[model samples]
Target chain A: MELLKQRINKDGDIKEGNIVKVDSFLNHQIDVELLNEIGKEFKSRFSLEKIDKILTIEASGIAIAVIVAQYFNVPVVFAKKTDSKNLDKDTYESKVYSYTKDKTYTIRVSKKYLNKGENILILDDFLAKGKAAEGLIDIINQSNSNLIGVGIVIEKGFQNGGKNLRDKGIKLESLAIVDSIENGKIIFR
Target chain B: MELLKQRINKDGDIKEGNIVKVDSFLNHQIDVELLNEIGKEFKSRFSLEKIDKILTIEASGIAIAVIVAQYFNVPVVFAKKTDSKNLDKDTYESKVYSYTKDKTYTIRVSKKYLNKGENILILDDFLAKGKAAEGLIDIINQSNSNLIGVGIVIEKGFQNGGKNLRDKGIKLESLAIVDSIENGKIIFR
Candidate 1:
């Protein structure tokens, strides 16, 4: 976690409206080496839980989930943001409101992929308002799967997403939590 | 490659309009173990070349590219399908037409990630018409990057995408080439 926090400080871009862009190494262009480290850290953090599968929302989360899944020795199921013809007709769906895009989109996972009573750990890159995380959790619940925890690479602590999930007693582990940004400098918790 | 072919035969769903859905292991729901095998196979296929970075598109390709990057010990850079504020203004862009969606969309990669003269290997989940692969190649060319080759997990040999890339003298390696599907059976080349 310390390593991730340091990397964020060194490479993360602090912008207005609490936008922390770690795209240089985290999202757009990925650092597989660092992702492996993140995998190990998540493994250590969730060593006790029975994680049958890792679930994530597509685009950025796919990279982190797939890498982290290597350590867990579990398969990953990503919720597709768009309705593609390739996707299964029978799916568990949830609506996510993306503030960045200023619109709502549906995220879905095939009913065949997620089964009942399976222990699931949700992993993602950023946790801002928790809309995406909430959407994933909703799908997991609909499938009657057990929620083990949520592991995030970077959490915007300034936002209420982390607090709300914690309040609901969800086991949320964020490697780096940026509490605030001042003069284009990231302040981590 | 035999393992991948076997997986496709066992779990791949052959639908109308020449759709082969291997979402169980390759894309939607991912088997990390199988992906590691894919990574090893790609490394062996492109063993003679010097791969500086692995380039791919978002959603499904991110998972494969990240896993494949481990074998090459290189970073993976994925082109963004949708424009997000997180992406840089300076980018290499290319337009791709999607037959499934019946629309064309732009894919962009940050100018910072892809450098001139860098050797890039484009990896993707599927190659039907090769529109996505062509778009990626265009971006690589715009950046003045050297495209080492294009690697596809499954190439619809019935389509002309594979032929076109091969005709262009590109080192395109498709682990499993489906020549045709007959009576709900996949014929591999």
Candidate 2:
């Protein structure tokens, strides 16, 4: 966790409205080695739970989830943001609000993936308003699966995302939680 | 490659609109072990190229690219479908038409990740229309990078994607190229 916060401070960029861009490593051009480290950290933190699968949203979360899946030794299921012709009809759907894009999109997972009573660990790159995580949780809950916990790489703590999930008694663990972003300054919690 | 085609014959669903859904293992719910085999197959196919980096588009492509990267022992740079606050402004953008969704979307990669003249191997889950591969090629061209070849898991040979790429003299290796889909039978070329 200290290593993550250090990496964030070293490479993260802060913008207006508490936005932190770690694209140089995390999302766009992935650092697989660093992700391995983050994966190990998540494994160490959530070792107590029995994680059957790792679920994440498409586009960005897939890489993080795949790396984390290596540690958990479980399959990775990514909820697609857009329905493609290739996607199956029998799917679990959930609506998500994107704070960055300022849009609400539906995330979908094949019903065949998440089975009943299976334990799932949700992982993603960023948690701003908790919409993405909430949507994933919604899909996992609909499948009657056990929610182990949520693991995030970078969290906007100033936003109510971390608080909202905690309010619901969810065990949310973030590697680096940003307390505030003021005038391009990043303060971590 | 045989394993992938075998997987398609076994688990791939032949739906209307000439669609084949491998969500059971390839796209939605990923089998990491199988993906590892796929990575090895890709490595064998593109054995001649000095692949410095693995480039792919997000969502489904991310999983295949990452699994393939392990075989290449290189970093994977996935193009971002939706530009979020986390995405860097200095990006390489390409427009791709999704025949599956009947829409066009932009894929962006941070400028920092892809350097000029870097040998790149584009990886994707499916090669239907080759629009996505062309878009990625366009981006890599714009970045002044070297595109060694494209590695696709499945190709809808009934469609013109494989032929189109071949006509352009682009080296494309698809694990399984389906020539026809009739009466729930998938004929391979």
Candidate 3:
């Protein structure tokens, strides 16, 4: 986590309105070695828990989840953000409000992917308003599956997403927690 | 390669449009052990070439490229399909046509990640129309980087992507090349 925070300080870009971009490693361009380390860390933390499947959202989270899934030795199901010709109509859907993008989009996973009494571990790149994570949790809840925990790479600590998940008694582990961005600088917790 | 073809035969879903969906273990739900095998296989094939970096596109390609990067002991730079807040303005962009959706989209790589004269190996999940592969090649061409080769997990041999790339004297290797699909049956070359 220290390494991630340091990398964020060195290469991360801070935009206005508290937008933090770690594209150099996290989003746009990826550091595979760092991702392997993160995977190991996640494996160490959640290895104890019985995780049936690893869940994440499409685009950003897929890379990290795929890396993490190696250690867990499980299959990864990424929730597609857009409707595709391939995805079945019978899907468990939920809406996520993206503060940065200023809109709500439906994230869906096929109903066949998640099942009853399965232990699910949700993973994602960023947890802001917790909408994305909550949406995944909502799908898992609908399936009558057990929501084991939520793992995130970066959490906007200033935002209520991480806090709300904690209040609801969901086990959340964010690798890097940003306390605030003071004067266009990052302050980590 | 035989294993991959066999896996495809076992789990891949053949749709009406010659679209084989290996979501169970390839794209939607990834198998890291299989990915590890793929990474090792890619390294074995491209071991002689001095690969400076591994390049791929977003979504499906990210997972394979990241895993393969470890074997090459290099970083991966995935092309962004959208110009998000995370990506910087300066980029090497290229247009890619998707056969699945029957649409074209622009993919961008940060000017920082890809450098001139760097040796890059393009990796992706499927090589159908080869638009994605060509798009990556275009970015590599623009950056003045040497495209060592292109790696693909599955190839629709009937589609002409691999043949086109090969015709241009480019090294394109597909793990499993499907000759045809008849009556929901896959015939591999």
TM-score winner: 1
Query: For chain B alone, what TM-score does every candidate structure achieve against the true structure?
Result: 0.98, 0.97, 0.97
Q: Chain B TM-score of model 1, please? A: 0.98
Candidate 1 lDDT over A46-101, as tens digits, reads 99999999999998999999999999999999999988878889999999999887
Tens digit of lDDT per residue, candidate 2, span B1-189? 678788899998888777888888888888888888888899999887899999998888998898789778888998877767667788889888887789888988888988998999999988987899999999999999999999998998988888999998999999899988889988887
Candidate 1 lDDT by residue in tens digits, B1-189: 899999999999999987899999988999999999999999999999999999999889999999999999999999998987667889999999988767899999999999999999999999999999999999999999999999999999999999999999999999999999998899999
- How many Å off is the CA of B31 in candidate 1? 0.5
Q: Judged by TM-score relative to the true structure, which candidate is superior, 2 or 3?
A: 3
What TM-score would each prediction reach against the true structure?
0.99, 0.94, 0.96
Candidate 3 overall Cα lDDT vs. reference?
0.88
Two-chain DockQ for each candidate model: 0.88, 0.71, 0.70
Roughly what TM-score does model 2 have, to 2 decimal places?
Answer: 0.94
Give candidate 3 misplaced runs (Cα > 4 Å).
A183-185
- In candidate 3, position A160 carries an lDDT of 93
Q: CA lDDT, every prediction?
A: 0.94, 0.87, 0.88
Candidate order, DockQ descending: 1, 2, 3
Per-residue lDDT for A91 in model 3? 91
